[model samples]
Target: MQDAGFVWNAEELDAFIESPRKHVRGTNMSYPGERRPEKRAAIIEYLTQLSTAD
Candidate 1:
């Protein structure tokens, strides 16, 4: 979201994953969110791994 000045770092990613709409108002993301903290953490971890894979 360059227009919104949103950065995609881990901490921002965590909050955005928790609630897309709340984190970035007017977001088109339809998925509600991962309500469980553990699950969210897992998702973020998996994503991080994917991004770093070589």
Candidate 2:
């Protein structure tokens, strides 16, 4: 992803989370993607919690 010029920040993460393959062509991720806005938000929120947990 670094080679693709992806900074992997929140905005980029959000886009990637929405559509992995579309956002990063050639991605190995097989997740069709979360079509629901609330689900996506929950996923991001959960990931945020995981990152901040200590």
Candidate 3:
């Protein structure tokens, strides 16, 4: 939960993966989130591993 209002947690990640524009309006990004649910899961898993690494 880095952001005050929005926490980058699993639930939020699911929503974001579903649709980047819907998740955050007027978003500025070169490429939007993955269209495939499985791919999104992989990316999230990788991120979690990195985040938890000490």
Best by lDDT: 1
What lDDT does each candidate get? Answer: 0.84, 0.81, 0.75
Candidate 3 weakest ten by summed lDDT: 1-10
What is candidate 3's lDDT per residue for 34-53, written digit by digit as tens? 78888888888998999999
The pairs that clash in candidate 2 are none
- Candidate 1 lDDT (Cα, whole model)? 0.84
Candidate 3 residue-wise lDDT at 38? 86
Candidate 2, residues 1-54, lDDT tens digits: the string is 667686766777778888999999888988888777788778888888999999
Candidate 1's clash total is 0
Estimate the overall C-alpha local distance difference test score of candidate 3: 0.75
TM-score of candidate 2 against the unseen true structure = 0.79
Best by TM-score: 1
TM-score of each: 0.85, 0.79, 0.73
How well does candidate 1 match the true structure in TM-score terms?
0.85
Q: Please give, for residues 1-54, the per-residue lDDT of candidate 1 as tens digits.
A: 556576788888888888988988888999898778888889889999999999
- Scored against the true structure, residue 12 in model 3 reaches a CA lDDT of 82
Q: What's the distance in Å from true for residue 29, model 1?
A: 0.6
Question: Where does candidate 1 stray beyond 4 Å?
Answer: none
